[model samples]
Target chain A: MTYRDAINAALAEELERDERVFLLGEDVGLFGGAMAVTKGLYERFGERRVQDMPISESAIVGGTLGAVLTGLRPVAEIMFIDFVGVCMDQIVNQIAKVRYMLGGQVEVPLVIRTQGGGGKSYAAQHSQSLEAWFMHTPGLKVVIPSTPADAKGLLKSAIRDNNPVLFIEHKLLYNEKGEVPEGEHLVPLGQARVVREGSGLTIATYSRMVGLVQQAAEGLAAEGTEVEIVDLRTLTPLDEETMFASVRKTGRFLAVEEGHLTAGVGAELVARVTKNCFDYLDGPPERVAAQDRPIPCAPALEKATLPQVEDILTAARALVG
Target chain B: MPDMTVPPLPPETMRALLQGMMRVRAFEEAVHDLYQRKLLPGMSPHLSAGQEAVAAGVCLQLRPDDYMVTTHRGHGHSLLKGMDAQRMMAELCSKETGYCHGRGGTMHIASPEVGCLGANGIVGAGLPIAVGAGLSIQYRGTDQVCVAFFGDGASNQGTFHESVNLATARKLPVVFVCENNIYALSTNFARTGATPNVVDRARGYDIPGVTVDGMAVEGVYAATTTALERARSGQGPTLIEAKTYRYYGHGASDHRPYRTKEEEAQWRCSDAIQCYGDLLIERGVATAAERDDLSARAAAEAQAAVDFAVSSPDPDPARVGDYVFA
Candidate 1:
């Protein structure tokens, strides 16, 4: 199944399983979502459960917060992660702070699903990975699934989570096909999976970057360098144990991310590995991330702006050297 | 204007309304005293001293199952919505026994049991949430109606316009109550909007909009009753703008530097609690001694709440990291 189909299946199952679960967003109902992930949900669930919201991002988020407080579990889509800037107040201040500030008086069981990545040449506004922004927040659980199986499992987990979660899907990974488990596949949040095992180096990445890292790992393996690839399913409650174990075994670390280099998730991973496994390292940890610039509309320019497989390979070679 | 005919309410109902306003006034007075004595925390208190009628009148019309979203100046609304006075005082005092276990101070006090979603700190954030609750009610096929209580200043917020439009488009069961207190902090209502009245802007949403004298409790109550009736019958939402004023400054420390003393005195002359009490007596609904007894009882209750808050234990430091997530 495709990653998009997996997400659609998760939404469909959750909506069927729980009466309180509903989906609302721009073009999500009749338009079947801009990504077509919600193509048949409106017909299956009807207009009441699958709703088409107005263009107001603030209302979409704020309304979800309100609905969750009452009884309903609302899965709201922001269409694209870049547009989250318009509704940051509701996300950062209201939704993120409600559970903490309310002293656990209320549980905000809400899932905000959005897609982010730069490969589609969708320009500066539409294509950007902003997982680091939500990872820094205290009350939010940030999840980014790399594969079809992970996407389906993580989405179901996020839906069942009693706290507010930012379920980020990579725009480039929607069409990527992979075998997914048939039923009741639930990947717990804050757990990392070792997609490939090796002893020479640990290549830590998430979302779309995981594929690039895997391609780089395969090329490195051809040259007798076995690279361990760790796909971090969730970011906020990071799987430090899995990362530390891999870094300990490989004695080399390279964090790859699609977001910008400066103060990105890659930087955090490098800092964490360096601090925790300083004794196990052969050399300084390395990182491969998008350049600190807005993604341009041109295909070559956007490709150059983002970190590619060659960049991951070079970063990995340096880390292993 | 000629004398308006006062609606004849039962003696019990009249006393209840008067006592509700009295409780709010007394509770705010005690809170002010606590702040002055430096007994409470350093947070600024947004007192609804003069706008008690709007809170009491509108909330009285709501069923226990109905939901309400309030503003930063939400003490009166919270009190009338049946939030425990002692727990509310404890919350303001930062005691663990508070409504939110001392996490949400005054601006975010919530009691979902009484159907108050929360009191928002943002200017117009509660409007959309109220609409969402309305949507939930409609989806569940419940008879519950949600009310969003905001100020005239919040009407200028985009959330207010967006929420009203959505509520109308979906015909959500909700009521939008605008407490026009004439000022958003120091800014006058005229300086904030192109329209002279908040109710005038409701025409664009195509909902029933009415303006009532907020100082007259009966007028607010009557308008709210009609709005609730319309909402419960699935007639969609109603916008009721109550023309009210704040006797105190925006916060406890704010002095009378923004408006003229004459203007302040003019509003104080028609204070909601004072007018309602006078009307009750003039209509022979209650005697003078009975009204005075209610005032004493309310003052005693306020004092008891203060004592309870003061004596309440602080949260343990070991549990400080709790409640970040469910």
Candidate 2:
């Protein structure tokens, strides 16, 4: 199934399983979603279950928090991840802190589905990775799945989670096809899967970066450098055990991410490896992330800015040496 | 508008309304005294001392299961909506026995049992959350309505406009209650608002907008009931602008540098609790003795709450990480 189809299936399955689960966003229903991730959901669920909201991001997020507080598990879409700036207060202040500050009196069982990453030359605002923003928040869980199967499984888990989750999908990965489990596929959050296990060096990444790293790892393997690829699916509860164990074995670490290198998720990963596996490290950890600038609309500039297959190969070759 | 005749209500309800105002007034007075003594920590509590009638009048129309979201000055609404005064005071004291286990202070108290979603620290933030609750009710096919209580200052917030437009567009069952305390923090509504009334803005959303004498509990009660009926019957949201005033400064320790003492005194002439108490006696709902006895009881309750807070243990330092997740 395609990544988009997998998400639609997960939504359909969750809606079928739980009566409380519903979908709402700016073009989710009738429009079949902006990316068509929620295609055919409106027809199956009807208007009551599949709500199409106005272009009010504050209402979309804050309203979802309120609904979850009152026993509804709503999957709200923000159309684009960049649009989150419009409703940062509702997302960061209200939804993120409501559960913790309210003394755990209620659970915000909701998911904010938004797409990030800069492959389509969508320009500065539309092509940004903001998973680190949600990871910084205390009460929120951030989920970013790379493959179609992981996408379906993680989305299911996210919707069923008792806490607020920011399920980020890559706009470029919508059509990436993989064999999604036909039914009852559940990938737990906070678990990093080893995509390519090797003995030489560890390259940890997530989302679309995981695929790019895998391709780079195949090339590195041809050069007699065995690079292990760890896909950090859930960023917040960050599976430190898998990362540290991989680093401890390899004695060399390189963090790859599509987000900006400054204060990015890669920055945090590198910091963690340096602190936890300092004595085990053969050399200092390296990070290959997007340049600290806005993603440009030009194809050549965008590719140069973001981490690429060749960039990963160079970073891995240097780390292995 | 109908004549300002007092609607005949059950004697018990009349007495409850009177007692509710008294409780809110006395509770805020106690909180004010605590601030004066430097017993409270963090930001000074935003007391809803003079605006008790608006809370008493509007909340009386809600069921225990109906949801409500209030603003920074939300003590009155939370108390009237069934939050225990002792726990509320304990929360203000940052004690473990508080409603939020001492995490949420005066500005952030919440109780799901009483259907109060929360009291937000941000201006106009509760509007959209309340609309979400209304949407929940619609999806669940329940008759419940949500009351979103914000101040006049929040009327200009983007959330206020977005929430109202969305609520009316969805025809969600919500009552947008604006406590027109004439000021948002220190700025007067006259300077901040486009019109003298916050309800006039509702016309833009095409919802029924009504203004009531927030100083008079009966008038507020009547206006709220009509709005509640309209909401529960699927007629959609109503904007209620309660022209009220806050007796104290925006927060504790804020002197009246923004307004004149004469202006403050003029507005306090019709104190909600005092006027409602006198009206109860005149209508034969309660005697002067009964009113005095209720006031005494309210004072005792406030005193008891303070005592409870003072005696309650502070939250455990070790469990600081607790309650961050489910």
Candidate 3:
């Protein structure tokens, strides 16, 4: 099924399963969500739960926090994650701090579902892999799902998770088709997966970059080098066990992130692995990431600035060969 | 204004009101003392020393099920809303025994059990939060009404307008109590609002707004009871402004330049805790000795809270990720 259809199925199934789950955001109601992820929810659920809110990010995020506190799982669509900056206080200050500050008295079981990544030609304002920004915050669960199955599974898990989860989907990968389970299934947080196993080297990635890693792995395998690709599905509850396990087995590591390299998710993974599995490394942990700058508008410049499949192949080759 | 019909309250209710005001006053005084000794870390404690009556008045009238979302100057509201003094003190001291377990410090304290959503540090922030609660009530088809407590400065925030207008339009079961303490942080109400009274601005939203003598517990209780009744009946929201004051600076850091000491001393004479106790005495609801006993009891309880907080254990660091996920 198409990734968009899977997301729609997840929302529909969850809505039917739990009365506490509701949807709100800009153009979420009658407009069917900006990304068409919530296509026909309004016709079924009506306007009460599938609420259309004013373009006030503060009110939307703050209201979501309040709703969850009062016993509801609210999935708010921000249209794009880059716009989340406007509601930083609501996200980092309120949502992230609620459980900790309240001494575990309350849990904001809320999900902010937004699409992000630089390949859409949506330019600087719309395109950005700011998962690193959310990943930096300990309380928040940052999920970037690349495939149709993961998009649905991750979102379902996010809705059920008590912490405030920032569920990011790649804008360009919406139409991509992949096999997904017909019924309900959940992928647990703080876990990583070996999407493609190989002994030559390990290519660690997530979200859109997982697909690039697959392409890079396939390209390198033809060159008589085997590349293992690992997908870090959930960034915050980072599965260090699986990461270190794979790295130790392969003894070579390459972290590829679509985000800027400066203090990116790559840096976090590098730091964590260094502390946990330093002895297992064959070479210094290599990061194939976007240039440390805001994404530019031109197509060629954008391609050059982002973490491409060739970059991952080059890093993978350097480590194993 | 006397046309306001009086509902007969329980005989013990007056005593309860006096007890609540005294408790808040004693509790705030302890917080002030604790601040002076540097016992509190990362706290901007906004004492409701003189403004104790508003919280006592409105919260005493509410059932334990009714919710309250308050502002930075929220210690009085929290205590009056039934938060244990010990937990509030622990919260102020940033201990694990606190309502927020050392993480919230003061601004972000919440007790879901008592229905005290929190005492927010940001101005005008609690209105939308309360509005969201009101929406939950309506969605669940319950009669629960949420009370949003804010100061005069918060009335000018964008949230105040958006929330009030939305609450009125939807006829949500919520009460907006604007404690018009004459100042916002240190800025006077007249400096920001052009409306003769902040309550008058609510007329534009088509909800009833009333300005009351905030120092009198009975007056505020009487006014809040009517508004709350109207809310529960789905008559819509009410914005009540209690003209009150704090005897101290906005945070603990103000150097007393914004207003004259005479103004502070003037408000101190009509202290809600003292005046309410006197009212109960004159009405024969309580004896002078009983009032003194009650005040002493409150003081003792506030001190006991400090002791409890000091004795509470530090949270285990491993559980830092506990509540972060369900």
| DockQ of all models, two decimals each | 0.80, 0.86, 0.49
- The TM-score-based order of candidates, best leading, equals 2, 1, 3
Q: Which one wins by lDDT: 1 or 3?
A: 1
Mind giving the per-residue lDDT tens digits that candidate 3 earns over B1-326?
Answer: 21256865676988888888888888888888888888888755888888888998899878898889998888888888888888888888887777777778878777878889988867888888888788778777889889999989988987888788777877889999999988777788898898868999977988888888899887889889889999999988999998888888888777669999888788888888777777777877889999999989999998999899878876667666556655
Better of 1 and 3 by DockQ: 1
TM-score comparison, 2 vs 3, better candidate: 2
Off by over 4 Å in 2: B1-6
Model 1: residue B41 alpha-carbon error in angstroms: 1.4
Chain A only, candidate 1, TM-score: 0.99
lDDT of 2 by residue, A1-321 (tens): 999999999999999999999999999999999999898999999998899999999998999988998999999999999999999999999998988788888888999999999899999999999898888888889999999999999999999889889999999999999999877999998999999899899999999999899899889889998988899999977999999999999999999999999898888999999999999999989999999989999999999899999999988888877
The deviation in Å at residue B176 for candidate 2 is 0.7
Model 1 per-residue lDDT tens digits across residues A1-321: 999999999999999999999999999999899999999999999999999999988889989988998899999999999999988888998999988777788999999999999888899999999999998899999999999999999999999999999999988899999999987999999999999999999989999988888888899999899999999999978999999999999999999999999999989999999999999999999988999999999999998999999998887777776
Clashing pairs in 2: none
> Candidate 1 regions off by >4 Å?
B1-7
TM-score (C-alpha, index-matched) for candidate 3: 0.92
| Model 3 segments more than 4 A misplaced | A317-321, B1-12, B192-197, B200-206, B278-287, B310-324
Candidate 3 CAPRI-style tier? acceptable
Residue range B8-64, candidate 2, lDDT tens digits = 889999999999999999999999999888888889999998999989998977999
Model 1 scores a TM of 0.98
Chain B of candidate 3 achieves a TM-score of 0.96
